[model samples]
Target: MFSNLAIDVALGLIFIYLLYSLLASIVQELIARLFNARARVLTKGLRRMLEDDDHSGDLGFFGRFTFFNFFYELGWSVVYFFQPFKNSPFLKQFYQSPAIRYLGENSAAARPAYISPAIFSQTMVHLLRGPHKDNQLSDADAIRECLAQNSLQLSADTLAHIRDLFEDARHDITAFRLLLEAWFNETMTRASGWYRKHTQAWLLILGMGIAAAFNVDSIAIARILMKDKSVREQMVQLAMSRQPQYAAITDTLIRKNVLHRDSAFFRTDTTWKVMVRDTSLIGVYGMLRNDLGDAKNVLGISRACVTDTTATGLPVVRCGFTHPYQRNGWLIAAGWAMTALAISLGAPFWFDLLGKVVKFRSAPPPNTTVTGE
Candidate 1:
């Protein structure tokens, strides 16, 4: 039902999205490494569950300013800008407690990215039991007593909720522990949602940045592919030739091994541990430089300078910061926005779509039997 030219153009666009999405993923991984994103997300979720104030709006004098006050009211305020985590005493203590204190690489500073439900139960039980010289009260009874006395400074709603869970468990310490684990697991599902939402925001920002840097205007690219028969043919050939390589990259086993330093490349069985050790941006880009070079060949995108002969037959081009955006600024911006949105959908999505499109193009047309309806 579709023309060959249309299919080829679609292939070229999908390939572009696939390449840029992979690049954006690498950048996102680097950012996650630098910020300990997983660990922070876990801690944030725990703080919210514990009803601990993370100093989200503890902005002292600045909190009086209309601008800061506006953000505070909008629920987009920050924590620890002026005052430290003074408002998060319980959370600070929980992290510093014996059960959790040594779980991370930097025991004194970093928090663990993952905390099993069992470990969470253990930590909660230990914190609830508190310090008693005699240790007279059993774990469940101690937690109940603490809640009754408001020793932990927990909110009335949290206190009532835990008390109900305890009652539902029939005050049996084992059952209470199980119930606690179940509750923690349920809360973590929401935590994962929080992480996903923030990650998408970061991906969008990275997509826009990469699209602008590379002049990957999707609209302009589609126009070029539609009008230039030679370029379309070349792009189709390029896509067909590189299909196996892209497939390998997208394979589940290979993707899982990407960040493992000692993992060997499955295709060549070669080691890349040495290459991964260099954390510099140049070193990181070097790992994917070959694919990037191929992507640069996609038509309608330009880098560096272009030369042309004037009416006098003299070269009138200088090699400076020449880019395709110098002309048709609005069109180029629109293209960049479109490309960015596609890239944000991610590498796997585009690659899978590319395979389907390629298959449809190659498959024989549906049977056209002349049977009467």
Candidate 2:
């Protein structure tokens, strides 16, 4: 009844709104880019101040893209990160944990968390030993053995979960050290059943981690903490709601699988622990298990020595650490390299595959090509 004149006026108003929104978005992007540029410039300057003139331009790239790095470079970075088992995968997780943001990609700490654990541990060692920080002994070979023996006893699937745990920590690897220490101290003295101690510790750490994640000003913590559980649940459900082709590889690692290491850590009743580690606590648990019973099967890793049995009650916990299918440096590198190469070389095909995996619901069909105009 109002005719096309009314429609014309409405279209004009819509166009004006669109223009304003576009301009605002563009300005916001420009300001963000400017800030990023400034931060990178300052980062370069600061490193030069502390380290050797950073003679290698490649170091900056390594510094920047170490996480999500291809297999070979990642291995080297892991080596340079820690002198002990730089050749091993532990370094990758250690360095990459302090500031990782599994919940948010854009966080600053995410990059550091991407670094290998070897680098972070070594860096800590250097700072501590450099006549300025703690005077920790450099007997990393012993420490590596302790952790290695411990890690090897774990099941392959359990090791996979721990690997994911490292990525999840990409926003806050530093907290790992505190938590790891807490794990040792708390694990040793607590008289409660191991499960109860574990429940309490995981809850405490998860609560703090989630809290930090949501505090906007906190570098390690992002906003995921404040989000309603419903929101987080929905987000996770949304991601996993799909039946992707890659689901086969992940099926063994899913939380509820009996063989999955996380299944044991989670089978507990606490809500906080269930959510925090989600499905990735097997990092150490699977390794600690010494018994494979008739009923069911289930798990330090450190570089320090404790030969003074009288002085220290136990330099090493009795967790068995001898058996597992070991995939050392070369094999590990080749596998990751294959994955990267697949995605990089077949990016378009992968994108198409991804599209198939996520079959998004469609909107209602448009009324007309010209619309209300």
Candidates in order, TM-scores: namely 0.76, 0.17
TM-score of 2: 0.17
Give the whole-model CA lDDT for all candidates, comma-separated: 0.69, 0.29
Report RMSD (Å) for each prediction in the order shown.
7.4, 28.0
- Record all residue pairs in model 1 with backbone atoms less than 3 Å apart, i.e. clashing: none
Model 1 TM-score on a 0 to 1 scale? 0.76
